[model samples]
Target: MFCDLIRGAAEVSICYEDATAIAFLDIQPVNPGHVLVVPREHYEVLQDIPKAVGAHLYQVATKLIPLVQTASNATDMNIVVNSGAAAGQNVMHYHIHLIPRKEGDGFDVPLPFPGSVMPNRQQLDAMAARIGSMLRDPLQNDGMKLG
Candidate 1:
């Protein structure tokens, strides 16, 4: 699906394109001129994308923000990335939403879990430590394991 869009096989209007990625107007836009930035190469999730390509995707997204705001006459914008199926990512391929915002636009960006309270500092700290450890060693084992 994404490949077709990038190759101009689809009727979607193209907003911008480069060697690494493409930005196109959203068919069902939150506001007029809303856009989606997608990498040329398909990645099922953000973590699956190479760091360089991921960074380029974000760079393209940043470039679109001003264009969307100016074209839609929006006061603000929201760049959203739903990483996984559990995060409301309908498409398997990675894409970033460039939603333009205006006063009383009536588009609400609800939290993943509404009315959730913050945990205590101690609990937060402990969780962060565990996550940090995972980042330092994803398998929870020293970097001795091979593919």
Candidate 2:
């Protein structure tokens, strides 16, 4: 769907464009002037995008933050990248949403979940160690199991 927008087949109110990426107003915005920055090349997932292209996407988004915020008269902004289907990503092609925020605008992101529990210190250590081990070496196991 986004590829169509990039190819000029579908209509888009483009705010920014370059060889690697394109930024346009979202068809259905969380707030007015919400912009979506996307890579020109089709990438199904965020990890599939090359490091340079991924970095470029963010760099462009950062540059656009002030523009969208000013246009929307927003007090703040939320730059969101819903990476996968499980993470509320409706679109398969990875894109970043630069949403302008205003005080009492009532546009809430569903970040808080009901009945979430805090982990103990040991659980936190074990989780961190697992992630750290994976970063250092994918195959190496810290052998710190948790329930």
TM-score: which candidate is best?
2
lDDT of 2 at 44: 85
lDDT of 1: 0.86
Residue pairs with colliding backbones in model 1 are none
Tens digit of per-residue lDDT, candidate 2, span 20-122: 9999999999889999999999998887888789999999999999989888899899999888999889989899999999888888776566566888999
| Model 2 TM-score, all chains together | 0.90
Least accurate stretch of 10 residues (summed lDDT) in model 2? 138-147
Across 1-147, the per-residue lDDT of candidate 1 in tens digits comes to 887887778897888888999888888888887898999888989878887899898888887888789988988998889999999998888999999998898999887658888899999999999977776795774463444
Pairs with backbone N, CA or C atoms under 3 Å apart (clashes), candidate 2: none
Q: Residue 134 lDDT in model 2? A: 77
